[model samples]
Target: MKSTITVSKKVKEVLERKKKEMEIKLNKPLSWDEFFQNIFREEEERIPKLTEEEAEILKDLTKEDRKNWRIREFV
Candidate 1:
């Protein structure tokens, strides 16, 4: 099976330019999937990892402490 999707020509042009920029920056050409994979991989690396102690502290936070931290829970 195959899927067809639509993109504006302007958006496609920007993506093409970005792809060329990335290929030059990395000193290698990339397939469409490779281009996006590198982006998502870098983003995942930027997110902070939590230790067990940190997870426990967050789980044990009281409503008041959570409020002070500006955390919200919808009923």
Candidate 2:
């Protein structure tokens, strides 16, 4: 199945440039789906995961504390 999506000209141009760059670097052609999948995979690997103990501790935190902790951790 195929679907259509609309984007601004600037966004389309940027994506086309990035697609070309990725295809050259990877030495293969990529469909739009594959390009997005690759990007998501790289992003998933870059973020940190908390352990079970850390998750439980977070659950006990007040809203303000949780917000502060996230700011400290991410920034």
Candidate 3:
């Protein structure tokens, strides 16, 4: 299916400018999704991986935070 979305002209202009900048930066033009995805991927790559201690602490914190418990049976 084809779809259309509406944004303010200013927003569209900014996105077009960003697209052009990314095309020059990456040496190829990309669709808006591709352009944004590349930025997300780059940002994700820059995030530090959790250490063992941090991972364990996060796990414990999440476990402690869980409150509701439920069981379901279906026939």
Highest lDDT, which number? 2
* Candidate 1 Cα RMSD after full superposition onto the native fold (Å): 5.6
TM-score of 1: 0.69
Query: lDDT for each of the candidates?
Result: 0.88, 0.90, 0.88
Across 2-64, the per-residue lDDT of candidate 2 in tens digits comes to 998999999999999999999999999999999999989989999999999998877767655
User: What is the C-alpha lDDT profile of model 3 across 1-75, one tens digit per residue?
Assistant: 657899999999998998899899989979878998988998999999999999999998888877555566798
After TM-score superposition, what is the CA distance of residue 45 in candidate 1 from its true location, in Å? 1.4
Question: In model 1, where do residues sit more than 4 Å from their true spots?
Answer: 1-3, 62-75
Candidate 2 off by > 4 Å: 57-75
Ranking by TM-score: 1, 2, 3
| CA error at residue 19 for candidate 3, angstroms | 0.9
Clashing pairs in 1: none
lDDT of 2: 0.90
Question: TM-score of predicted model 2?
Answer: 0.68
Q: How many backbone clashes does candidate 1 have?
A: 0
Off by over 4 Å in 3: 57-75
RMSD of 3: 9.0
